[model samples]
Target: MAIRNCLVTGAGSGIGAAVAELLSGQGHRVALAGRREEPLRELSARLPGPSLVLPTDVTRPEDIESMFAACEESWGPVEVLVHSAGAGDSARLESTTDTMWDRQLELNLTAPFRCVRRAVPAMRKAGFGRIVVVASVASKVGAPYVSAYTAAKHGVLGLVRSAAAELADTGVTVNAVCPGYVDTPMTDRSVASIAAHTGRDADGIRAKLAAAQPIGRLILPGEVAAVIGLLVQEEALNGQSLMVDGGSVQS
Candidate 1:
């Protein structure tokens, strides 16, 4: 396998951190980008290979440019990009505000879109690149009380497919990994939100979520990272939204 320059957003923790760790172990130079500098630096210190800790807010275009510039300055253009920075909040459709809707779109859909836009040009010139967006199973299916999140995920999956088609002849492949109820801090927050909204026990909500997957357990962040590792290594897998859920959506 080639040791490429990789950039992973949301690398402070969860799926992003796992992906960064896996790539670094495989001898890739990784750039850790996240909002918090401490965690990024902490992750960089532990990585097996070279790394750059870049604090960035993906919601800001200027910050995105700065992140790419820093990566370019350190190890050259990003040959592999994994966008795992996202958040989800639950609300009934009627109660979902414009702020909530926009936030979801910005974080989940627009940020990845911009990062791909920034990376693809160089990838086309080099004729080799891998881009993976850590999407959710919500990208595939609709559920109650998460209309905004579902819409954003669906749009991001569409973005992946369209971008992949456009870049079919290029060496760059665009794809998304859709995992269900991953055991991450994000899911922890989801559990809290659901419990607060429904006046249910948080532990019970979590158990219900785990059982939602046929495997009857929350998906592990490393499991999703392994799937991302596969996408990064395989050039033939483009424009596919792979389901990392335990056979929940059999697509």
Candidate 2:
């Protein structure tokens, strides 16, 4: 495998950290972007290959620019991009506030749009690149009690598909990976929040979430990471939203 210069957003933890570490292990130079510096710094030191720690809030256009600039400066053009920075809430539309609606869209949908602007140009110039958006099962199907989350993630799929169409003939491929009930820190928080709201124990809520997957368990972060690694190298798999939900949202 060629030593591609890759940039992964939300690299401090969850799917982003998993993808970044896996890419680094595959001999790629990774640029880690996240709000927290300490975790990125720690992950960078532990990576198998060289990495740049660019503590960035992906929602900010200026931060996105600086992140790409820093990565290019250190490792040349970024040949691969993984967008995993996302946040959402579990609220019905009637109960959702303006802040909740906007933040979900901004973080889950708009940030990828912003990051791709920085990536596509560099990728187009080089005539080779890969872009993967870490979307959700909510993007594919409707789930109750998380209207804002579902909307934003559905928007993410739209963005990914549109970008994929436009860049089809180009070497730059855009796609999405939709995961369901992953075993990560973020999911732990979600489980806790659901428990608080429903007056159920965390274990029960977790079991319910896991049972949503036909495989009867939570998906591992590394399982999703493995698919991302393949997408980065598989030129033919473009304009796709590969679901890693253990058959939770099968089409």
Candidate 3:
């Protein structure tokens, strides 16, 4: 694989961290972008190859622009962009406030769009690019009490498909990775929330969620990162949603 500059949003933890670490290990110049500076710095220190930490809130367009600018100044044009900067919500439709809906859309759907729009120009100039959007299994299947998150993820898939079509033959590929119940800080929080809501022990709630998957366990961050890595390969893979859900979504 040709050495390239890669930008990973939400690279501070979870799937984003794994993807950034993996890409750095594979000899790619990785730019880690996230709202938190501490983890980004830590990851930069730990990862191999050249790495840059651009602390950014993906919801802000200026921040996204600055992140790309920093990457270009430090490395070169961004050859790969992995958008994993998103938030999860669990509120029923009747209980979902307008603020919650807006927040979910801003973080999950609009933010990735802004990041990609900023990066696409440089990618077009280079005539080669790989964009991977981190969606969720909820995008395809209905999960109770998380309508806002599911809607945002569905929008993300739509964005990927539309952008992929527009960038086809332009050497730019756009795709989405839908992960289910990964063992991350986010998942930990979700488990705690479930425990509180159902008055069950944390272990019991976790076990129930894990058993919900056909694999009988929660997915791992590295497992999802591996799928992102595959999408970034030189092969022409675009407008596809690869689910890393432990067989939760068989479609």
Note the Cα lDDT for every prediction shown.
Answer: 0.95, 0.91, 0.91
For residues 1-251, write the lDDT of model 1, one tens digit per residue.
88999999999999999999999999999999999999999899999999999999999999999999999998899999999999987898999999999999999999999999999999999999999998899999999999999999999999999999999899989999999999999989998888887899999999999999999999999999999999999989999999999999999
Runs with alpha carbons beyond 4 Å of true place in candidate 3? none
Q: What lDDT score is found at residue 135 in candidate 2? A: 95
Backbone clash total, candidate 1: 0
Q: Relative to the unseen true structure, what is the C-alpha lDDT of residue 128 in candidate 3, on a scale of 0 to 100? A: 90
lDDT (10s digit) by residue, model 3, range 1-76: 8999999999999999999989999999999999999999999999988999899998888898898989888888
Compute the lDDT of residue 187 as modeled in candidate 2: 95
Q: Candidate 3 versus the native: TM-score?
A: 0.97
lDDT, candidate 3, equals 0.91
Q: How close is candidate 1 to the true structure, as a TM-score?
A: 0.99
The number of clashing residue pairs in model 2 is 0
* TM-score of model 2 (CA atoms): 0.98
Clashing pairs in 1: none
In candidate 2, the residue pairs with backbone N, CA or C atoms under 3 Å apart (3 or more residues apart, or in different chains) clash, namely none
Q: Which one wins on lDDT?
A: 1
